[model samples]
Target: MKNIKMTIEYDGGRYLGWQRLGDSDKTIQGKTENILTKMTGSEIEIVGSGRTDAGTHAKGQVANFKTSIDMDLPTMQEYLIRYLPQDIIVKELEEVPERFHARYHAVGKKYSYYVWNNVVPSAFERNYSFHYSEQLDLEKMNKACEKLIGRHDFIGFSALKKSKKSTVRTIDEISIQREDNLLHFTFIGEGFLYKMVRILMGTLLEIGSGITALEVIDTIFESGIRSEAGMTVPAQGLFLDEVYYN
Candidate 1:
């Protein structure tokens, strides 16, 4: 069997996230796997780099699958594009070494959250960004970002109730930029827990709105309590920007 790697981009607005569900075919994984299975005439299961929450989007999601089908890479990609739903597209496909496992080999990931800060919302960006009409102090948000950089236990910022695996993760960078009325927040990290990025963004937003103190980030870290952290922002604003592998 040859291992085929694929880079996928999806709007994710109408899907039920990336994983295949037993009862539902409205998932990215299930849809893609079904198409592959149909084309290959055999069972095909693709392993994704990670799972994005429902309603979240992805620009560079990666996955891989092993298949014995004789079709070339380009043909397989073309077949996928022609048959898969218009919202999900396989941008690139290539044969890779058999040892490559998408999830296990992933080194890092980048997630971005969009916020519309203006009082008037844009019809085009309504589904892609979080609209917050209150005035936000960008400088205060930047200051809060400083405390979030580097390695720390991020359990307080995730929706995971409990895990035996370590919650500690390294955040290489966190940047917030404003373009007109849109605030773009980017996070480059080794890994993140469930809903971690959304919660982090919510915390920073609260600080920017003067609803929470700057030092609360440290307090949340020390306490590792979910309730102490800010709200988990809506999933529509989050995007899995890229998955890194080497």
Candidate 2:
């Protein structure tokens, strides 16, 4: 068997998320697997570095799968490009060691949440960005990010009812930048809880808009309560920018 690795990019506007549902083809993983199955003449399941939630796009998402088909990467790439849905793109493909599992071997991930902070919204970016027509205090938002940028019990930021695994994760960085009317919030971390990035974005938006105190990040960390954070922002604004192995 050959272990294949690939970088995937997709516009997650119409899918039910990455995980394959029971007989549902409206998912990135399901769509990709279906094509792989057709190529291999057997059931083929690929493992992603992580799941990008529904309506969340990806630019450099990673995945790996074991295939016994005696095929070259170029031929496989051409096959996928010609057969898979238009929105999904296999950026690159290569053969790797059999032990390289995408999710298990992942070292870090980078996610970006985009906000359109303009008086008027863009007609093209409606599906890719969150529109908030209000002034945000970037200085205050940076302050909150400082408190959030370390290893901590992020049980409060997560959406799980109860975590079977540890909620402690290290956030290597979180920073914001503005260009024209767009505000980009980038998050780099070891790993994130379910919906944690969205939830954290919501909290920062509230703080940046002065709806919540900047120090609330500290309070949420201490309280370990989900309600202490702001609303879970919409998934359309989130993007899985990259997954790191080292």
Candidate 3:
């Protein structure tokens, strides 16, 4: 069998995330698998780098699958583009080494969150960004981002109730930028726990709004209590920007 790697981009507004569900076809992985299975005339399961929550988008999501099909990469990609839903597109495809497992081999990931901060809502960008009306203190938010950088237990910032695996993850950078009425937040990290980025965004927003003090991050780290952290932001604003492999 030959291993094939694919880079996917999806709007993710109408899907139930990336994983395949037995009862539903409303998933990115399920849709891709269905098309691949039909093309290869065999059962095909693609392994994704990671799962994005429902309504979350992706610009550079990666996956891999093993297949005995002898079709060339271009033909296979064209076939996928021809049949797969317009919202989900396989941007790139190539034959990969047998040992290249998408999830296990990922060394780091980058996520981007967008917020439409304005008194009036946007018609076109409503589905793509979170609409926040209140004024945000960027200086305060940047200060909070500094505190969240580096290695720390992030159980308080995630939705995970329990896990034997360590919750500690390294956040290399958190950048906050504004373009007109849009606020862009980028996170580069080794790995992130479930809902960690959304929760972190919420905390930072609260700090910016003066609803939560800057010291709350230190308190959450010390307590490791989920309730002590801020609310989990909506999924529509988050995007899985890229996955890095080495």
lDDT, candidate 2, 1-246, per-residue tens: 999998999999999999989967899999999999999899999999988888999999999999899888999999999999999999999899999999999999999999998889999778888998878989988999999999999999989899778899999999999998989999999999999999999999999888999888889899989999988999999999999986
For all candidates in order, the CA lDDT equals 0.94, 0.93, 0.96
Least accurate 10 contiguous residues by lDDT in model 3: 125-134
TM-scores of the candidates are 0.99, 0.98, 0.99
- Sorted on lDDT, highest at the top, how do the candidates line up? 3, 1, 2
Q: Least accurate stretch of 10 residues (summed lDDT) in model 2?
A: 125-134
Model 1 lDDT per residue over 75-129, tens place: 8999999999999999999899999999999999999999999999889998999
lDDT of 3 by residue, 21-105 (tens): 9999999999999999999999999999999999999999999999999899999999999999999999999899999999999
**Candidate 1 lDDT score relative to the true structure:** 0.94
Candidate 2 colliding pairs: none
Model 2: lDDT of residue 124: 77
Model 2, 39: alpha-carbon shift in Å?
Answer: 1.0
Q: Give me the displacement of residue 45 in model 1, in angstroms.
A: 0.5
In model 2, which regions exceed 4 Å deviation? Answer: none
